[model samples]
Structures are given as C-alpha cells and as structure tokens.
Target: METTSSVADIQMVTFLLGSEEYGVDVMDVREIVDITDVTKVANAPSHVEGVIDLRGSIVPIVSLKKRFGLPEAAAGDYNCIAVMDFAGALTGFVIDEVTDVIRVARRDILPPLELGSEPWMEGILSLGPRLIVVMNLKHLA
Candidate 1:
C-alpha cells in the first residue's frame, strides 16, 4: 500500500472515455471547456480535425479517438476539450468528460506495459481500482 504523502506527490487530471478512465499530467493541461463548435479545415491532416474559434483566435482541435485510431466518436458524446500547450502551440483534445484531479506516487505508478506492442500506451499508473493511462503529450501534441 502507498502512503497518502507519497501519492500526493504526483498529480494527474482524470477523464472518461467510453467506460475507460484515463489521466494526463495536470501541468500539461491549460484549460477545460465544454464542447465547442469546430470548423473543419480542408487539406489538413486526418489527425487534424480542424480549428475552432476559441475566443478570438483559431485553435486546433484533435479528436483523441482519431489520434489513437479508435472508431469515430458519436456526435455529442464529448463534454470537454482539454487544452494543452506544447512547443508553443495550444492544442485541444476532445474527451468524453472531465472527471477529477488526484495525486499518486512515483513509486505507485507503473510503466507502460504495452509499450512494445501499442507504442503509444506511454505508461500505466494504478490509482485505486482505476488505472490511468499516462500519455506522452509531447508526441501527442
């Protein structure tokens, strides 16, 4: 068992997709907002869904489903777009829902078990009965 002090050392932002629970480093997350209208951009990469008029600037939104090669997500399923800043660009990731913020320990967290196979699993950290998928945001963004 891990102690609270140890667990609190590591913080993560949790979210839900389908029935699965996933997490990303809280530091990478800039803001979370409800689903917004996305304007499709022609000639953009398939992974690049399009850009949205966020405030006054056009921000790119990427579907986590499409990025991971998962099937197309049903319309209206997502409730939040978790924006992350990487390499000076702000990218929004569409997720089913924002869950909670919690902490875990470096020791309690496990590495990517399917790294060799999945290549994108990054790592896996067990948080109680829920296992959080630690994504490599640098590559993801």
Candidate 2:
C-alpha cells in the first residue's frame, strides 16, 4: 500500500469586511450561510453578535467588523455568516461578503508588518492589485 500525504498549500476563503479584504484558512471554515436571526446573549462580549441555532447545534456568532474596530453596519442582503471551527468549538463570523476561494503557495504569504501588533492577522498576501489579510481564527475565539 502506498500511503501519500496531501501537501499543505495555502488555501483561504476570502471575504470582505467594509472596504478591506480578509481571508481565513479553508480548513477552519465549515460553511457559509446567509445572515439569519441571532438570539442575543446577555453579558456577552461586545464583539459577540449572538448565538444561532444551526441545525440543532448552537453556534455563537461574532461581528468581525466590531472585532476589527470598524463601524457597525446594519445587516444587508450581502451579509453572511462564515461558520468556522475554532479550537474544537464552532463559531460564526458575520462578514459583508464572501469573495472566493484562493489557492496560493505558502512561500507567497508575507509576514505582517511590525507596527501596532494585530494578533488576529496571520499574514498578508499580494494578489495583483489587491492585498488580502490572512487571519488567525484561533485569536478571534
């Protein structure tokens, strides 16, 4: 029997939050769902939007705009929830829009600049005229 391991390439689910583009590893993302009603949780963190019953499993939702210190916008038609597995727990991130699934070589990802530290930003990827900020989902949790 020939056992072959899959090579790890940088695969990301890209999305838009405000005017900026962001991405998370494809492995971390479970699925993307349309913006739905969220049951508010009392005394929850400011970034946490609320919880949603997704197919019987209660999934906590977070506003990436609030997490990134961006101004909050009313949920529009393009808004979506990016369900992700963070440290074994399923969490949903509310984003403006999901763009595409991009595949780039690991070597193409550039280390983030050492300015004000952003713990959630994993790295930066230059895709033609646009730059995508790859995020670390564990930090969001």
Candidate with best TM-score: 2
Candidate lDDT (C-alpha), each: 0.77, 0.87
Clashing pairs in 1: none
Please provide, for model 1 over 1-141, each residue's C-alpha lDDT reduced to its tens digit, 9 standing for 90 to 100.
Answer: 865475347678888766677788788899998887888999987877788877887889988877777776677777788888755788888888888898767666677775353544557877568777777677654
Q: Which is the leading candidate under lDDT?
A: 2
- State how far residue 61 of model 1 sits from its true place (Å): 0.2
43-97 per-residue lDDT for model 2 (tens digits): 9999998999999999999888888898788656447899999878999989899
Give the runs in model 1 whose Cα sits over 4 Å from its true position.
1-8, 114-120
